[model samples]
Target chain A: MLSIPIEYYLILSAFMFIVGVTGVLIRRNAIVVFMCIELMLNAANLSLVAFSSYHGNPVGQIFVFFVMTVAAAEATVGLAIIIAIFRNKLTVNVDEINIFKW
Target chain B: MNIELILFIILATIAAVTSILVITRSNAVISAVFLVLNFFALAGLYLLLNAQFISVVQIIVYAGAIMVLFLFVIMLLRTDGEPRIFSDKRYIKYFALLISIFVFIQVSYLLLIGSPSKSVTGNQSASINSGTIETIGKELYTNYIIPFEVAGFLLLAATIGAIILAKKKFE
Candidate 1:
Protein backbone atom coordinates (compact mmCIF):
# COMPACT_ATOMS: atom_id res chain seq x y z
CA MET A 1 0.00 0.00 0.00
CA LEU A 2 1.26 3.41 -0.94
CA SER A 3 1.49 5.97 1.86
CA ILE A 4 0.82 9.66 1.66
CA PRO A 5 3.35 12.19 2.85
CA ILE A 6 2.49 13.89 6.14
CA GLU A 7 2.93 17.27 4.54
CA TYR A 8 -0.33 16.80 2.67
CA TYR A 9 -2.23 16.49 5.94
CA LEU A 10 -0.44 19.48 7.45
CA ILE A 11 -1.17 21.62 4.43
CA LEU A 12 -4.80 20.63 4.46
CA SER A 13 -4.99 21.48 8.16
CA ALA A 14 -3.45 24.87 7.49
CA PHE A 15 -5.97 25.57 4.74
CA MET A 16 -8.82 24.65 7.02
CA PHE A 17 -7.40 26.84 9.76
CA ILE A 18 -7.18 29.80 7.43
CA VAL A 19 -10.74 29.28 6.24
CA GLY A 20 -11.88 29.19 9.86
CA VAL A 21 -10.02 32.39 10.60
CA THR A 22 -11.58 34.14 7.64
CA GLY A 23 -15.02 33.00 8.73
CA VAL A 24 -14.44 34.30 12.23
CA LEU A 25 -13.26 37.64 10.92
CA ILE A 26 -15.92 38.26 8.29
CA ARG A 27 -19.10 36.62 9.56
CA ARG A 28 -21.31 38.90 11.64
CA ASN A 29 -23.52 36.14 12.95
CA ALA A 30 -22.31 35.09 16.38
CA ILE A 31 -23.38 31.47 15.93
CA VAL A 32 -21.64 31.27 12.61
CA VAL A 33 -18.59 32.68 14.27
CA PHE A 34 -18.90 30.00 16.88
CA MET A 35 -19.09 27.45 14.10
CA CYS A 36 -15.97 28.91 12.62
CA ILE A 37 -14.23 28.58 15.95
CA GLU A 38 -15.29 24.95 16.01
CA LEU A 39 -13.84 24.62 12.55
CA MET A 40 -10.54 25.95 13.83
CA LEU A 41 -10.57 23.54 16.73
CA ASN A 42 -11.23 20.65 14.39
CA ALA A 43 -8.38 21.77 12.22
CA ALA A 44 -6.03 21.63 15.17
CA ASN A 45 -7.36 18.22 16.12
CA LEU A 46 -6.62 16.96 12.63
CA SER A 47 -3.04 18.09 12.87
CA LEU A 48 -2.59 16.51 16.27
CA VAL A 49 -3.85 13.17 15.00
CA ALA A 50 -1.67 13.43 11.92
CA PHE A 51 1.42 14.06 13.98
CA SER A 52 0.53 11.25 16.38
CA SER A 53 0.57 8.80 13.53
CA TYR A 54 3.76 10.25 12.19
CA HIS A 55 5.65 9.92 15.49
CA GLY A 56 4.50 6.39 16.19
CA ASN A 57 3.00 7.48 19.46
CA PRO A 58 -0.50 7.23 20.94
CA VAL A 59 -0.07 10.36 23.05
CA GLY A 60 -1.35 12.65 20.38
CA GLN A 61 -4.42 10.58 19.73
CA ILE A 62 -5.16 10.55 23.45
CA PHE A 63 -4.77 14.30 23.48
CA VAL A 64 -7.32 14.48 20.69
CA PHE A 65 -9.81 12.74 22.97
CA PHE A 66 -9.33 15.49 25.51
CA VAL A 67 -9.67 18.11 22.83
CA MET A 68 -12.96 16.64 21.71
CA THR A 69 -14.21 16.53 25.28
CA VAL A 70 -13.24 20.15 25.82
CA ALA A 71 -14.85 21.06 22.55
CA ALA A 72 -18.12 19.48 23.65
CA ALA A 73 -18.02 21.32 26.91
CA GLU A 74 -17.20 24.50 25.09
CA ALA A 75 -20.13 24.05 22.74
CA THR A 76 -22.55 23.55 25.60
CA VAL A 77 -21.35 26.59 27.50
CA GLY A 78 -20.94 28.66 24.37
CA LEU A 79 -24.41 27.97 23.04
CA ALA A 80 -25.88 28.70 26.40
CA ILE A 81 -24.05 32.02 26.47
CA ILE A 82 -25.24 32.73 22.94
CA ILE A 83 -28.80 31.95 23.90
CA ALA A 84 -28.56 34.20 26.95
CA ILE A 85 -27.21 36.97 24.78
CA PHE A 86 -29.92 36.43 22.22
CA ARG A 87 -32.61 36.52 24.86
CA ASN A 88 -31.35 39.79 26.32
CA LYS A 89 -30.37 41.48 23.05
CA LEU A 90 -32.95 39.92 20.70
CA THR A 91 -30.34 39.43 18.01
CA VAL A 92 -27.46 37.06 17.25
CA ASN A 93 -25.33 39.35 15.17
CA VAL A 94 -22.01 40.14 16.75
CA ASP A 95 -22.08 43.73 15.59
CA GLU A 96 -25.48 44.41 17.15
CA ILE A 97 -24.83 42.70 20.49
CA ASN A 98 -22.01 44.90 21.63
CA ILE A 99 -23.00 45.86 25.14
CA PHE A 100 -19.41 45.34 26.14
CA LYS A 101 -18.13 47.61 23.39
CA TRP A 102 -16.69 50.97 24.29
CA MET B 1 -1.30 7.14 -7.62
CA ASN B 2 -2.25 4.24 -5.37
CA ILE B 3 -5.57 3.55 -3.66
CA GLU B 4 -4.63 5.01 -0.26
CA LEU B 5 -3.26 8.17 -1.79
CA ILE B 6 -6.31 8.48 -4.01
CA LEU B 7 -8.60 8.06 -1.02
CA PHE B 8 -6.64 10.64 0.90
CA ILE B 9 -6.87 13.11 -1.96
CA ILE B 10 -10.59 12.58 -2.35
CA LEU B 11 -11.35 12.89 1.36
CA ALA B 12 -9.05 15.89 1.78
CA THR B 13 -10.76 17.62 -1.12
CA ILE B 14 -14.17 16.95 0.35
CA ALA B 15 -13.01 18.23 3.75
CA ALA B 16 -11.45 21.40 2.40
CA VAL B 17 -14.39 22.22 0.12
CA THR B 18 -17.01 21.55 2.79
CA SER B 19 -15.06 23.57 5.36
CA ILE B 20 -15.03 26.49 2.93
CA LEU B 21 -18.75 26.07 2.45
CA VAL B 22 -19.24 25.91 6.19
CA ILE B 23 -17.91 29.43 6.55
CA THR B 24 -19.22 31.04 3.35
CA ARG B 25 -22.92 30.14 3.37
CA SER B 26 -25.21 32.87 4.64
CA ASN B 27 -27.59 30.54 6.42
CA ALA B 28 -26.34 29.32 9.77
CA VAL B 29 -28.22 26.04 9.44
CA ILE B 30 -26.74 25.40 6.04
CA SER B 31 -23.33 26.19 7.42
CA ALA B 32 -23.89 23.69 10.23
CA VAL B 33 -24.81 21.01 7.73
CA PHE B 34 -21.67 21.69 5.79
CA LEU B 35 -19.65 21.55 8.99
CA VAL B 36 -21.12 18.11 9.60
CA LEU B 37 -19.86 17.08 6.19
CA ASN B 38 -16.46 18.49 7.03
CA PHE B 39 -16.40 16.47 10.23
CA PHE B 40 -17.20 13.26 8.36
CA ALA B 41 -14.44 13.92 5.91
CA LEU B 42 -12.02 14.65 8.71
CA ALA B 43 -13.02 11.41 10.36
CA GLY B 44 -12.07 9.61 7.19
CA LEU B 45 -8.72 11.37 7.26
CA TYR B 46 -8.18 10.23 10.85
CA LEU B 47 -8.92 6.67 9.80
CA LEU B 48 -6.31 7.02 7.13
CA LEU B 49 -3.90 8.21 9.80
CA ASN B 50 -4.52 4.97 11.70
CA ALA B 51 -6.20 6.77 14.58
CA GLN B 52 -9.31 4.67 14.44
CA PHE B 53 -10.41 5.46 17.98
CA ILE B 54 -10.16 9.18 17.44
CA SER B 55 -11.95 8.82 14.13
CA VAL B 56 -14.93 7.16 15.79
CA VAL B 57 -14.95 9.79 18.53
CA GLN B 58 -14.80 12.50 15.88
CA ILE B 59 -17.98 11.14 14.34
CA ILE B 60 -19.81 10.61 17.61
CA VAL B 61 -18.79 13.74 19.50
CA TYR B 62 -18.36 16.21 16.70
CA ALA B 63 -20.66 15.20 13.85
CA GLY B 64 -23.31 13.74 16.14
CA ALA B 65 -23.59 15.38 19.56
CA ILE B 66 -21.90 18.79 19.35
CA MET B 67 -23.53 19.64 16.05
CA VAL B 68 -26.91 18.72 17.48
CA LEU B 69 -26.24 21.18 20.28
CA PHE B 70 -25.37 23.85 17.72
CA LEU B 71 -28.53 23.15 15.74
CA PHE B 72 -30.61 23.24 18.90
CA VAL B 73 -29.20 26.64 19.78
CA ILE B 74 -29.78 27.84 16.22
CA MET B 75 -33.42 26.78 16.38
CA LEU B 76 -33.87 28.21 19.84
CA LEU B 77 -32.53 31.58 18.77
CA ARG B 78 -34.58 31.51 15.55
CA THR B 79 -31.72 33.03 13.59
CA ASP B 80 -33.44 32.37 10.28
CA GLY B 81 -33.59 36.01 9.33
CA GLU B 82 -30.64 37.05 7.22
CA PRO B 83 -28.08 38.73 9.39
CA ARG B 84 -25.73 41.37 8.18
CA ILE B 85 -22.92 39.64 6.33
CA PHE B 86 -20.18 42.05 7.33
CA SER B 87 -19.44 45.04 9.48
CA ASP B 88 -20.04 48.50 8.05
CA LYS B 89 -16.36 48.98 7.24
CA ARG B 90 -15.61 46.91 4.16
CA TYR B 91 -11.88 47.50 4.61
CA ILE B 92 -11.76 45.21 7.61
CA LYS B 93 -13.04 42.34 5.51
CA TYR B 94 -10.55 42.99 2.75
CA PHE B 95 -7.79 43.15 5.30
CA ALA B 96 -8.93 39.89 6.85
CA LEU B 97 -9.08 38.15 3.51
CA LEU B 98 -5.61 39.38 2.65
CA ILE B 99 -4.22 38.19 5.94
CA SER B 100 -5.82 34.77 5.57
CA ILE B 101 -4.35 34.30 2.12
CA PHE B 102 -0.94 35.40 3.33
CA VAL B 103 -1.07 33.02 6.23
CA PHE B 104 -2.12 30.18 3.95
CA ILE B 105 0.74 30.86 1.55
CA GLN B 106 3.30 31.11 4.31
CA VAL B 107 2.17 27.93 6.04
CA SER B 108 1.97 25.94 2.82
CA TYR B 109 5.42 27.11 1.83
CA LEU B 110 6.86 26.10 5.17
CA LEU B 111 5.09 22.76 5.12
CA LEU B 112 6.33 21.97 1.66
CA ILE B 113 9.90 23.15 2.13
CA GLY B 114 10.85 22.56 5.76
CA SER B 115 12.48 19.32 6.74
CA PRO B 116 10.52 17.90 9.65
CA SER B 117 12.88 17.51 12.61
CA LYS B 118 11.95 13.92 13.36
CA SER B 119 12.04 11.31 10.68
CA VAL B 120 8.91 9.17 10.71
CA THR B 121 9.89 5.65 11.66
CA GLY B 122 6.40 4.28 12.28
CA ASN B 123 5.61 1.12 10.42
CA GLN B 124 2.14 0.98 8.93
CA SER B 125 1.14 -2.24 10.62
CA ALA B 126 2.49 -1.07 13.97
CA SER B 127 0.57 2.21 13.74
CA ILE B 128 -2.63 0.44 12.77
CA ASN B 129 -2.42 -1.88 15.73
CA SER B 130 -1.38 0.86 18.10
CA GLY B 131 -4.35 2.99 17.15
CA THR B 132 -6.84 0.25 17.69
CA ILE B 133 -9.64 0.77 20.17
CA GLU B 134 -8.21 -1.83 22.51
CA THR B 135 -4.81 -0.20 22.58
CA ILE B 136 -6.29 3.23 23.12
CA GLY B 137 -8.49 1.95 25.88
CA LYS B 138 -5.66 0.31 27.68
CA GLU B 139 -3.46 3.33 27.47
CA LEU B 140 -6.23 5.74 28.37
CA TYR B 141 -7.32 3.78 31.39
CA THR B 142 -3.85 3.12 32.67
CA ASN B 143 -1.37 5.88 31.86
CA TYR B 144 -3.88 8.67 31.31
CA ILE B 145 -6.51 7.80 33.87
CA ILE B 146 -6.14 11.00 35.86
CA PRO B 147 -6.74 13.23 32.87
CA PHE B 148 -9.65 11.07 31.87
CA GLU B 149 -11.37 11.53 35.22
CA VAL B 150 -10.65 15.23 35.18
CA ALA B 151 -12.30 15.42 31.82
CA GLY B 152 -15.36 13.79 33.34
CA PHE B 153 -15.51 16.51 35.96
CA LEU B 154 -15.10 19.19 33.34
CA LEU B 155 -18.04 17.84 31.42
CA LEU B 156 -20.16 17.85 34.53
CA ALA B 157 -19.22 21.43 35.29
CA ALA B 158 -20.05 22.44 31.75
CA THR B 159 -23.46 20.79 31.97
CA ILE B 160 -24.32 22.66 35.14
CA GLY B 161 -23.01 25.90 33.77
CA ALA B 162 -25.02 25.55 30.58
CA ILE B 163 -28.18 24.88 32.53
CA ILE B 164 -27.57 27.90 34.69
CA LEU B 165 -26.87 30.15 31.75
CA ALA B 166 -29.92 29.02 29.84
CA LYS B 167 -32.24 29.36 32.78
CA LYS B 168 -34.99 31.92 32.38
CA LYS B 169 -33.96 33.76 35.53
CA PHE B 170 -31.52 33.27 38.36
CA GLU B 171 -34.22 33.01 40.98
Candidate 2:
Protein backbone atom coordinates (compact mmCIF):
# COMPACT_ATOMS: atom_id res chain seq x y z
CA MET A 1 0.00 0.00 0.00
CA LEU A 2 2.39 2.62 -1.20
CA SER A 3 0.22 5.68 -1.27
CA ILE A 4 1.56 8.87 -2.76
CA PRO A 5 3.43 10.63 -0.01
CA ILE A 6 2.15 14.00 1.18
CA GLU A 7 5.55 15.46 0.39
CA TYR A 8 5.10 14.91 -3.30
CA TYR A 9 2.00 17.09 -3.39
CA LEU A 10 3.82 19.64 -1.30
CA ILE A 11 6.78 19.62 -3.66
CA LEU A 12 4.47 20.24 -6.56
CA SER A 13 2.82 23.06 -4.64
CA ALA A 14 6.22 24.61 -3.92
CA PHE A 15 7.22 24.47 -7.55
CA MET A 16 4.04 26.21 -8.66
CA PHE A 17 4.36 28.85 -5.97
CA ILE A 18 7.94 29.61 -7.00
CA VAL A 19 6.99 29.90 -10.63
CA GLY A 20 4.22 32.27 -9.55
CA VAL A 21 6.69 34.35 -7.56
CA THR A 22 8.94 34.57 -10.58
CA GLY A 23 6.05 35.70 -12.74
CA VAL A 24 5.00 38.37 -10.29
CA LEU A 25 8.53 39.65 -10.15
CA ILE A 26 9.50 39.56 -13.81
CA ARG A 27 6.29 40.37 -15.63
CA ARG A 28 5.16 43.97 -16.03
CA ASN A 29 1.66 43.57 -17.45
CA ALA A 30 -0.97 44.08 -14.76
CA ILE A 31 -3.14 41.24 -16.05
CA VAL A 32 -0.22 38.85 -16.11
CA VAL A 33 0.60 39.82 -12.56
CA PHE A 34 -2.99 39.08 -11.59
CA MET A 35 -2.74 35.65 -13.18
CA CYS A 36 0.39 34.99 -11.19
CA ILE A 37 -1.54 35.79 -8.04
CA GLU A 38 -4.13 33.20 -9.00
CA LEU A 39 -1.32 30.74 -9.55
CA MET A 40 -0.10 31.33 -6.03
CA LEU A 41 -3.59 30.86 -4.61
CA ASN A 42 -4.00 27.62 -6.52
CA ALA A 43 -0.69 26.39 -5.19
CA ALA A 44 -1.85 27.01 -1.66
CA ASN A 45 -5.14 25.23 -2.31
CA LEU A 46 -3.29 22.17 -3.59
CA SER A 47 -1.37 21.73 -0.37
CA LEU A 48 -4.47 22.35 1.74
CA VAL A 49 -6.35 19.64 -0.08
CA ALA A 50 -3.37 17.34 0.21
CA PHE A 51 -3.12 17.84 3.94
CA SER A 52 -6.89 17.60 4.36
CA SER A 53 -7.03 14.22 2.73
CA TYR A 54 -3.82 13.17 4.40
CA HIS A 55 -5.15 13.86 7.90
CA GLY A 56 -8.69 12.62 7.23
CA ASN A 57 -10.19 15.97 8.22
CA PRO A 58 -12.66 18.16 6.37
CA VAL A 59 -11.53 21.41 7.96
CA GLY A 60 -8.82 22.05 5.42
CA GLN A 61 -11.23 21.48 2.59
CA ILE A 62 -13.61 23.96 4.20
CA PHE A 63 -10.74 26.43 4.34
CA VAL A 64 -10.09 25.81 0.69
CA PHE A 65 -13.73 26.64 0.00
CA PHE A 66 -13.36 29.95 1.79
CA VAL A 67 -10.15 30.66 -0.04
CA MET A 68 -11.87 30.09 -3.35
CA THR A 69 -14.64 32.53 -2.50
CA VAL A 70 -12.20 35.15 -1.40
CA ALA A 71 -10.17 34.56 -4.54
CA ALA A 72 -13.22 35.16 -6.70
CA ALA A 73 -14.05 38.41 -4.97
CA GLU A 74 -10.46 39.55 -5.11
CA ALA A 75 -10.19 38.84 -8.81
CA THR A 76 -13.26 40.88 -9.68
CA VAL A 77 -12.26 43.89 -7.61
CA GLY A 78 -8.63 43.75 -8.70
CA LEU A 79 -9.52 43.49 -12.35
CA ALA A 80 -11.93 46.35 -12.05
CA ILE A 81 -9.13 48.44 -10.61
CA ILE A 82 -6.91 47.39 -13.45
CA ILE A 83 -9.63 48.38 -15.86
CA ALA A 84 -10.08 51.73 -14.21
CA ILE A 85 -6.38 52.40 -14.38
CA PHE A 86 -6.26 51.35 -17.98
CA ARG A 87 -9.12 53.67 -18.85
CA ASN A 88 -7.28 56.63 -17.40
CA LYS A 89 -3.64 55.78 -18.06
CA LEU A 90 -4.19 53.78 -21.25
CA THR A 91 -1.72 51.21 -20.00
CA VAL A 92 -1.47 48.25 -17.63
CA ASN A 93 2.29 47.97 -17.26
CA VAL A 94 3.20 47.88 -13.58
CA ASP A 95 6.22 50.08 -14.05
CA GLU A 96 4.26 52.81 -15.76
CA ILE A 97 1.43 53.11 -13.22
CA ASN A 98 3.49 55.35 -10.98
CA ILE A 99 0.93 57.78 -9.61
CA PHE A 100 1.55 56.62 -6.05
CA LYS A 101 5.32 56.24 -6.33
CA TRP A 102 6.04 59.61 -4.74
CA MET B 1 3.28 2.05 -9.51
CA ASN B 2 -0.42 1.80 -8.91
CA ILE B 3 -3.12 3.49 -10.97
CA GLU B 4 -3.41 6.42 -8.57
CA LEU B 5 0.31 7.01 -8.63
CA ILE B 6 0.36 6.88 -12.39
CA LEU B 7 -2.56 9.29 -12.52
CA PHE B 8 -0.89 11.55 -10.01
CA ILE B 9 2.32 11.63 -12.02
CA ILE B 10 0.51 12.46 -15.24
CA LEU B 11 -1.69 15.14 -13.72
CA ALA B 12 1.21 16.62 -11.80
CA THR B 13 3.22 16.88 -15.01
CA ILE B 14 0.35 18.61 -16.74
CA ALA B 15 -0.16 20.97 -13.84
CA ALA B 16 3.54 21.80 -13.62
CA VAL B 17 4.07 22.37 -17.33
CA THR B 18 0.89 24.39 -17.83
CA SER B 19 1.65 26.60 -14.83
CA ILE B 20 5.04 27.35 -16.32
CA LEU B 21 3.41 28.13 -19.63
CA VAL B 22 0.89 30.37 -17.91
CA ILE B 23 3.64 32.49 -16.44
CA THR B 24 6.04 32.58 -19.38
CA ARG B 25 3.73 33.13 -22.33
CA SER B 26 4.22 36.55 -23.87
CA ASN B 27 0.61 37.29 -24.77
CA ALA B 28 -1.89 37.68 -21.95
CA VAL B 29 -4.61 35.78 -23.82
CA ILE B 30 -2.25 32.92 -24.39
CA SER B 31 -1.36 32.97 -20.74
CA ALA B 32 -5.05 32.83 -19.83
CA VAL B 33 -5.58 29.77 -21.98
CA PHE B 34 -2.60 28.03 -20.46
CA LEU B 35 -3.94 28.93 -17.03
CA VAL B 36 -7.23 27.25 -17.86
CA LEU B 37 -5.33 24.15 -18.83
CA ASN B 38 -3.39 24.34 -15.61
CA PHE B 39 -6.62 24.59 -13.65
CA PHE B 40 -7.98 21.48 -15.30
CA ALA B 41 -4.84 19.59 -14.42
CA LEU B 42 -5.18 20.73 -10.84
CA ALA B 43 -8.82 19.66 -10.83
CA GLY B 44 -7.71 16.22 -11.86
CA LEU B 45 -5.18 16.18 -9.08
CA TYR B 46 -7.94 17.22 -6.64
CA LEU B 47 -9.98 14.25 -7.79
CA LEU B 48 -7.01 12.00 -7.23
CA LEU B 49 -6.76 13.47 -3.76
CA ASN B 50 -10.36 12.38 -3.16
CA ALA B 51 -11.75 15.90 -2.95
CA GLN B 52 -14.51 15.44 -5.45
CA PHE B 53 -16.42 18.65 -4.62
CA ILE B 54 -13.36 20.87 -4.56
CA SER B 55 -12.23 19.41 -7.85
CA VAL B 56 -15.53 20.35 -9.46
CA VAL B 57 -15.29 23.83 -7.96
CA GLN B 58 -11.79 24.11 -9.36
CA ILE B 59 -13.23 23.56 -12.81
CA ILE B 60 -16.47 25.52 -12.50
CA VAL B 61 -15.44 28.46 -10.32
CA TYR B 62 -11.83 28.62 -11.46
CA ALA B 63 -11.53 27.26 -14.97
CA GLY B 64 -15.04 28.25 -15.93
CA ALA B 65 -15.78 31.54 -14.19
CA ILE B 66 -12.61 33.15 -12.85
CA MET B 67 -10.51 32.45 -15.91
CA VAL B 68 -13.31 33.79 -18.04
CA LEU B 69 -13.20 37.01 -16.07
CA PHE B 70 -9.43 37.07 -16.62
CA LEU B 71 -9.78 36.55 -20.34
CA PHE B 72 -12.40 39.27 -20.56
CA VAL B 73 -10.14 41.73 -18.81
CA ILE B 74 -7.19 40.88 -21.01
CA MET B 75 -9.28 41.42 -24.13
CA LEU B 76 -10.72 44.66 -22.78
CA LEU B 77 -7.27 45.96 -21.95
CA ARG B 78 -6.20 45.29 -25.53
CA THR B 79 -2.55 45.12 -24.50
CA ASP B 80 -1.32 43.18 -27.49
CA GLY B 81 2.35 43.60 -28.40
CA GLU B 82 3.18 45.51 -25.25
CA PRO B 83 6.96 45.63 -25.39
CA ARG B 84 8.70 43.51 -22.86
CA ILE B 85 9.91 45.51 -19.85
CA PHE B 86 12.41 42.85 -18.88
CA SER B 87 15.27 44.70 -20.52
CA ASP B 88 15.73 47.05 -17.59
CA LYS B 89 15.92 45.99 -13.94
CA ARG B 90 17.25 42.61 -15.07
CA TYR B 91 18.94 42.10 -11.71
CA ILE B 92 15.64 42.24 -9.84
CA LYS B 93 14.47 39.26 -11.81
CA TYR B 94 17.59 37.40 -10.85
CA PHE B 95 17.15 38.39 -7.23
CA ALA B 96 13.59 37.14 -7.11
CA LEU B 97 14.56 33.96 -8.89
CA LEU B 98 17.33 33.38 -6.41
CA ILE B 99 15.02 33.89 -3.46
CA SER B 100 12.40 31.52 -4.87
CA ILE B 101 14.88 28.76 -5.65
CA PHE B 102 16.47 29.17 -2.22
CA VAL B 103 13.15 28.85 -0.43
CA PHE B 104 12.22 25.79 -2.50
CA ILE B 105 15.50 24.12 -1.60
CA GLN B 106 14.91 24.80 2.06
CA VAL B 107 11.41 23.31 1.94
CA SER B 108 12.48 20.23 0.05
CA TYR B 109 15.43 19.75 2.34
CA LEU B 110 13.14 19.78 5.35
CA LEU B 111 10.68 17.41 3.75
CA LEU B 112 13.33 14.91 2.78
CA ILE B 113 15.37 15.06 5.99
CA GLY B 114 12.46 15.03 8.43
CA SER B 115 11.09 11.60 9.22
CA PRO B 116 7.52 12.55 9.92
CA SER B 117 5.68 9.59 11.35
CA LYS B 118 3.46 7.51 9.06
CA SER B 119 0.84 7.15 11.75
CA VAL B 120 -1.04 10.09 10.25
CA THR B 121 -2.14 8.00 7.31
CA GLY B 122 -5.90 8.50 7.10
CA ASN B 123 -8.60 5.88 6.86
CA GLN B 124 -9.61 5.42 3.22
CA SER B 125 -13.37 5.40 3.63
CA ALA B 126 -13.37 8.31 6.00
CA SER B 127 -11.16 10.38 3.73
CA ILE B 128 -13.46 9.71 0.81
CA ASN B 129 -16.54 10.67 2.77
CA SER B 130 -14.89 13.75 4.17
CA GLY B 131 -14.77 15.24 0.68
CA THR B 132 -18.36 14.47 -0.21
CA ILE B 133 -20.98 17.18 -0.67
CA GLU B 134 -23.21 15.85 2.07
CA THR B 135 -20.49 15.81 4.69
CA ILE B 136 -19.25 19.25 3.69
CA GLY B 137 -22.76 20.67 3.62
CA LYS B 138 -23.53 19.43 7.09
CA GLU B 139 -20.28 20.78 8.45
CA LEU B 140 -20.69 24.11 6.71
CA TYR B 141 -24.25 24.57 7.92
CA THR B 142 -23.72 23.41 11.47
CA ASN B 143 -20.24 24.44 12.58
CA TYR B 144 -19.26 26.97 9.91
CA ILE B 145 -22.45 28.94 9.53
CA ILE B 146 -20.97 32.25 10.50
CA PRO B 147 -18.17 32.00 7.99
CA PHE B 148 -20.59 30.92 5.30
CA GLU B 149 -22.81 33.96 5.82
CA VAL B 150 -19.77 36.19 5.93
CA ALA B 151 -18.59 34.83 2.63
CA GLY B 152 -21.96 35.68 1.11
CA PHE B 153 -21.70 39.24 2.40
CA LEU B 154 -18.19 39.43 1.09
CA LEU B 155 -19.35 38.43 -2.36
CA LEU B 156 -22.09 41.05 -2.30
CA ALA B 157 -19.61 43.73 -1.34
CA ALA B 158 -17.27 42.62 -4.09
CA THR B 159 -19.99 42.78 -6.69
CA ILE B 160 -20.93 46.33 -5.71
CA GLY B 161 -17.32 47.38 -5.45
CA ALA B 162 -16.49 46.04 -8.85
CA ILE B 163 -19.41 47.90 -10.36
CA ILE B 164 -18.42 51.11 -8.66
CA LEU B 165 -14.77 50.75 -9.54
CA ALA B 166 -15.50 50.12 -13.18
CA LYS B 167 -17.83 53.10 -13.47
CA LYS B 168 -16.34 55.81 -15.66
CA LYS B 169 -17.27 58.74 -13.44
CA PHE B 170 -18.53 59.18 -9.89
CA GLU B 171 -22.12 60.39 -9.74
The docking quality of candidate 2, as DockQ, is 0.71
Backbone clash pairs for candidate 2 read none
**Residue B162 CA error for candidate 2 (Å)?**
0.3
**Best candidate, lDDT:** 2
Candidate 2 Cα RMSD after full superposition onto the native fold (Å): 1.6
- Deviation of model 2 at B19, angstroms: 0.9
Clashes of 1: 0
Off by over 4 Å in 2: B82-89, B115-119
On residues A1-99, what C-alpha lDDT tens digit does candidate 1 reach at each position? 216678888889999999999999998889999999999999999889888887777888999999999999999999999998988888898888877
Per-residue lDDT tens digits for candidate 2, residues B89-170, read: 5788789889988988998888777734265565678789888988888999999999999999999999999999999887
**Residue B28 local lDDT, model 2:** 91
Q: Give candidate 1 regions above 4 Å deviation.
A: B80-89
* Highest TM-score model number: 2
